[model samples]
Target: MAGEMAAGLAEEGGSKIKMIVSYVDNLPNGSEEGLFYALDLGGTNFRVLRVQLAGKEKRVVKRESREVSIPPHLMSSNSSELFGFIASALTKFVADEGHNALFNDRQRELGFTFSFPVRQTSITSGTLIKWTKAFSIDDAVGEDVVAELQTAMEKQGLDMRVSALINDTVGTLAAGSYYDEDVVVGVILGTGSNAAYLEKASAIPKLEGDIPKSGKMIFEKLISGMYLGEIVRRVLLKITLQSSIFGNIDKTKLRTHFILRTPDISAMHHDGTPDLRIVAEKLADNLKITDTSLETRKMVVEICDIVTRRSARLAAAGIVGILRKIGRGNPGDKHKSVVAIDGGLYEHYTEFRQCLESTLTELLGEEASKSVTVKLTNDGSGLGAALIAAAHSQY
Candidate 1:
């Protein structure tokens, strides 16, 4: 995977991994002050947050946020409709905050955390490369996402400036760097997996124009929360057809794509009951499979374990690949490398998290592993965007 990242960075076409430039030349130094806003549009839901910073001493003074679910139809809708809905939600969120003396005096600055692949042209502007996850807006492709949001905000009569444009991984890295200087990489193992790591400007050959002082590269991976359950479902379907462990049950739900989710498998994998009640219940509830014997329940658990373990180990290898690319994976190198991780799979799924951490340590060996740490930054994507906005505020 690391080799693929290098190829993607060097090659313009036909590369699996896209080491796209983020144009985020600098990370937060913890000196950012004043009120800032963050708009996070990742998947099915988008979030709006307002955070007040008091520099290095006070950190985040006050923060409030709201999550709004996007209508299913809007995922594939035109850019105007989708962004307009987002703008309206953002307007309402700002209105709900009421009149704030701190915000009323100045033009509000916002960081847009767009968790899609984008070709960033500047710190505050980027063109959408392609939409991932559930989003497939045709017109939005190659469009300046920041500009779209800016126009939408204007149409809604909201006075806000988009100070920064970033993806979730970059936001995580920024948020992590604000607290820990050792954090060099940010990995998101959520609904979709991706990573961002700082790199020397000269290291990226495919990068065009005048390179900044530094650059961050984005790496998208296939192993993530969004596909884990689907993988398990396919395996179960295969076994059910061949072995019929599920008995003579309707396999309609099992055949349905994404009918079984990561949370369901996580619950089944963590079943500790002597009879594996949770596994049976999940199979019954999600797939309508019931009256499973102890052996069958154990098989289901094993399948979940297999899928989760594979996903975790693969993610670990990817992280190590990043470390190697940056020369931090050398045996004698004692430099501490902290990877700040966000996303539901890394946060909520205990088995996946443990497997990922342990696999990382295993791949790095005992000596090099001692200098590595994986820290979870909860809601770091949104908060980190706000921090970046503060760092680049117009005021």
Candidate 2:
């Protein structure tokens, strides 16, 4: 199903894949310098960073970062309140920087990494299409997210300019490309899943009038971390309804939505004990379903394996689809290329990563597989935003 989804997304008028356009075209070129700020608003926690870049000579001079978790009540609250909360956090983080030597008098330039779907109008502005990953803000939908953040900054009395608005996947690409020119793909496989790749403007039929000088598009919206855990939860729900293997514990835990999170399922799948003790313990601890037999534990692990395997295999297909779309994985193609990957799922889940690589090898075959590599690049989302800010700063 994921492979089908990916393929459909690649097609010009493909169904199922939304294939939304990101209006960003500026990419980092290693020459970006000076002080920049990054705000990564994705998932349950948002991260803020202050980076000191010294062009190509010293690269990153110094960095400081802080993470702030949103209370459940804030996610669905008024947009002004939520962004105001974020602005307050940013103000506190900046004030904490004090009169350090790295400090400059210039107003800060910020790259806002909004990880939801947006109809981008420019490099620095976009309208939020909708919220995903359990976020449902009615007012934020269709509003200019950049303007919202800017207004919040004003309320905080912060002297800053919003230089770039980007998706996390796009930030990953910018950061990865800064380090490796061969890196053409940026993927996030953490709590959610998404990919951003360089697409030729000519190939994108959805783009109208005045194509970018780079003639490229950042393709996101499929094969990412935000939906993987939910997919696993759905499959598990189906299995519990159909099977007696789970036994008669209060179906309460299983009935709860998103209760069986990806990390819990991953820990169980990685358990290698002869009796699968870790799986049993995790099930009992998370679901409160104790008194499980070894056979039942085995069955639970099998279900996890099945779900994650599909996710991994489909991720592989998405990568392959991008390669084929860009004319890389074809016969006689020999140039080496790298796909830079970030996010928790790809980094921590050993089984999922291995399955993804192996499946890629299987699909690309021996020859073409040798020309492609998926390299893990950590913290690209937050840091990439700063890099983009420096690259596209108005100052």
Candidate 3:
């Protein structure tokens, strides 16, 4: 699957999938020093962060952050309602910072991490192509998200300017790049999967002249959290129907879409007891099936492993493809390479992380694999946004 996805990305307009070109020309060079704000609107939550940078020697000096949950209705409501709530929350956050000694009179600059499908027109503007992860705001589609956010900020009387509009994956890369120049790719494995990597401007035939500085390409969708559980559920559903393992059980939960979440599957996969007690308990609790035989228990465990392993292996393949695209596939290419990865699944799930690492070693072989590393970065949507804002700040 990773190989297939890579094949699509290698061509203009793509053969199998269309990869979006983010017109973000610049990446952080660890020299940007300022107080910047970051607004990250992800699938289920929005996070805000403020960072005070002390330039190359000191890096990030001080930081403060807050996370707020979006009410369910706002996800499907009007764009104004959604952005308004976000702006209101941001206003309070900014007000609290007013007392901080680190703050200055310079006009504030922000980096907005909008994790959705967007047709980017520039560093600070992009048209929403569509919503994903169950978001369905009708008016947001085709609208410039940066503009939407800026308008909301204005309504709240927030005197701040958006300096950069970034994808989460791109933010991850920026965050990683701020610390390490070798970091070449950024991937997100939670809720939804996607990747961003620096690509040569000449390689993207679909992108015309006036390309941005960082010449990068980001895959909007791939082996991510939102679809992994569904994939596992479909496989489990087929097996349950065919084998009748539960013997006329309710199976209603199994039938429901996304009833089996990625974290649930990851938890089951990590169970290591003799009889896999945790798996049995979770199956009973989540699926309402109990008193399973050893064979049934084993089957359940195997299913979890299978689903997780496939996702991890496929993720490894995607990483390999990116490395190869950039000529890092050679055994003697000694430049230490790093792929900065972020997301709850990649961070928390040990089995998944180990499997991904082992698969990369297998794919790249010993000599070549030594140079490539998958380094986990924290808070891509928050700290990363602040970093980009600092790098692109007008002040």
RMSD of each: 4.0, 5.0, 3.9
Ranking by lDDT: 1, 3, 2
TM-score of each: 0.88, 0.83, 0.89
Candidate order by TM-score, decreasing, is 3, 1, 2
lDDT of 2 at 31: 79
Top lDDT prediction, candidate number: 1
Clash count, one per candidate? 0, 8, 4
Off by over 4 Å in 3: 1-12, 71-77, 99-105, 133-135, 209-222
Q: Candidate 1 vs candidate 2: which has greater lDDT? A: 1
- Give per-residue CA lDDT, model 1, range 215-302, as digits (tens): 2222222378977888899999999999867789998998999999989889999898999999988888889988999999898899
Task: Mark the 10 consecutive residues where model 2 has the least summed lDDT.
Answer: 211-220
Model 2's alpha-carbon lDDT is 0.78
The alpha-carbon deviation from the true structure for residue 266 of candidate 3, after best TM-score superposition, in angstroms, is: 2.2
lDDT of 2 by residue, 146-261 (tens): 99999999999988788998888888888898888788888887766677887666656546532122112122222444454555667656777888666666777767776767
